[model samples]
Target: MGRNGVDRDRYQASQSCSDRFQGAFGAPRAEREQQFSKFMEHLPLAVSIKDKSGRFLFANEFMKDLLAADDPVGKTLGELLPPEEASMMAVNDHQALTQGLLLIQNRVNDTYGDERIFETYKFPLPMPEKRTLLGSISVDITERKRAEQALALKQQQLEELNRSLEQRVQQAVDELRQKDRLLIQQSRQAAMGEMINNIAHQWRQPLNNIGLIIQNLQLQYEAGEMDSEQMATEVGKAMDVIAYMSRTIDDFRNFFHQDKERQPFVVNQMVSRSLDFVLPGLKNSGIDVECREEPNVSADGYPREYMQALLNILNNARDVLLERKVKQPLIRIAIFRENKRSVVTIHDNAGGISDDVLPKIFDPYFTTKEQGKGTGIGLYMSKTIIEKNIEGSLTARNVDGGVEFRIVV
Candidate 1:
């Protein structure tokens, strides 16, 4: 409005309030001009007017404080601002002159060297003498921009975390499946070894009987007493023993068969079948075994796994009896129903397990036997089969004079 400074008279002459508010509000020229100057000085927004050449013609009090400049009038943006910011302002001024209106968002450093964002509106104003001025108002938007940036970063982090969690879960599932396969293989290996030992014990008596029958036939022939009826009788007795030995193989095969489905089966029957495979060894070892069966007690689960668990317990009992060789060695199996569940208890008199060793008996790879003699997964797998697969429980405790293993289904 004035050269080298703001001239009070020139600034007052530029006020067009009277023309805008004529009949509705009447006031003296001086009074209206003072009101306009006061209003512009107190406004919160940064307001300024520039010539077509991007030179500041007028700047409000807020604009002066925003730029930290002593006087902005008659100064070009290039002279008043840093090179990069001046260049950006120059471009915006040119667009406002050519396009009539321009709106933009920009980043700039304030007088304190702190960064700030501004949403600016620029428009052209035609003056009386064919001259044009560009007017602009800007509001700080730094907080809003920072919030948007922070929200975007958080969303990205959450997505990456979700992906990482999915990968970890899949890896865990794969590991569990591998462990299951290993357990099954180990169980089969243990069962196979037990079967071989039992078969040896089972066949020994029948083989010796056949040998004796052959010896008897020789003796009869030498004496000239061999008759057709006597020969048939001797042969029939030998065949019966051989047939009984053959059935042992069938029993072993059925015991190891993998069952795919669960069904209701008598608990006592399953326990008896498991004992059949080990009875010969028990007899030969002179470890007396007695079964006290209770009728009509049934369960719903994998019968083969149930049998395997029972066999493992029995085998453990047999081993302890033989290893310790307790006087009058005895192992007792009892099956009955209690609390609406089938229960089986196997008790052995071998001085029971030591207090320290009893607690860890069901832990995987923990064995009392020498390294090559025990796979240790037997009791652990048995626990898994009963608790997880069969939805039942297996527990061990020291009784009055022996160790008791109990299964509840």
Candidate 2:
């Protein structure tokens, strides 16, 4: 009973083991093959299998649709695609068969008239007869390629725009700097001309006095009435007049000197120096000048530039006074401290600026004077000097019976 029972149990166990092996190796293998074939047929990629001779052994539905072909099995790539595409695919197939496996990326036009890109993975499939089949799976990469290209183009455009913008900004800055330089140069020229005119006016009286003194000295010496003491006094007087003229030249030179750095300067000194430049002309024009100052009032700036600004204001005032020929013409300058800032006001009794012309007075090249008499750069340059160089403000307004120019530094 034991031996027969043992034999029967062994047979049953052997049969059960055999069935389990068949299920594990056969059933699942077939199921997986079926699943893979269905996946390849429906996948969103072109799948193909070709013999080493480039004859199509299999083609998935996607491949057939891509080529606009019906049945593709047993057909060559040359029969299913354009000559160019077929030749390219044949070369890849040959490479896969000879080189074991190959990867290729190419572009083509689909049957639907759309451009497409594909990355194909091609490998050899070993057959029972030692023949090789080329297996290929290619995904449509058209959208990805297009997106990458668009992004590259956009990046290039942005870079170009940035470059153009930088160039334009730099050009604008350069042009502005040039304009500033021109304005400064022209203003200096105008001030120099005025300085020369003042020098002439200042020299006139001294020259006339010297002529009178020399004539008298010659007359006395010829008449034998010249004494040593009288000669000494007369010479001393002539020397004093010459020294005065020399000092006047020095004052003019200093006023036009180029100041390279900012320094604290007394407001009254700056005013007096500027007035010294035009004093003779002011007196010649019968223009009475009055100045009042608050003690210790000082400003930190280029003194020459400040003096030039003051000269511009004073000259403008003098011009207005003479042009209008107002009775008892007068220019009044006052300097004081206001809100921790040095303030200067120059006003003249030349009938206030017309309301219509007031607002544009400070604009470059704007002037009420007739053409050729005024360059119109004086006030504009003055404002530029105060605001830009001195970090100050200059404003003008009609006060009492005249125009008043105010500078705050």
Give all candidate RMSDs, comma-separated. Answer: 7.9, 10.9
lDDT of 2 at 182: 91
Per-residue lDDT tens digits for candidate 1, residues 4-89, read: 33343224225533344433456776676576678778988788887777777678887898788888877889998889889988
Candidate 1 versus truth, CA RMSD in Å, comes to 7.9
**lDDT tens readout by residue for model 2, 1-409:** 2445434433433333344455655766556556555666678888776656676656679988877888766667788788988898788788888887798898877887888898989998664446555778888888898999999999999999999999999999899878877987889899999989998998999999999999999999999999999899899999999999999888877766788889999988989888888998999989999999998789899988999899999999999999989899999999999999999999999989888899988899998899899989899989999998899999999998999999999
Error of 2 at 111 (Å): 15
For residue 106, give model 1's deviation from the true position in Å.
18
Question: What's model 1's lDDT at 105?
Answer: 93
Model 1 stretches astray by more than 4 angstroms: 1-156, 212-236
Candidate 2: deviation at residue 319, Å?
1.3
Q: What is the Cα-based lDDT of residue 141 in candidate 1?
A: 86
TM-score of 2: 0.62
Candidate 1 has an lDDT of 0.84
lDDT of 1 at 215: 91
Give TM-scores for every candidate, taking all chains together and pairing residue i with residue i.
0.61, 0.62
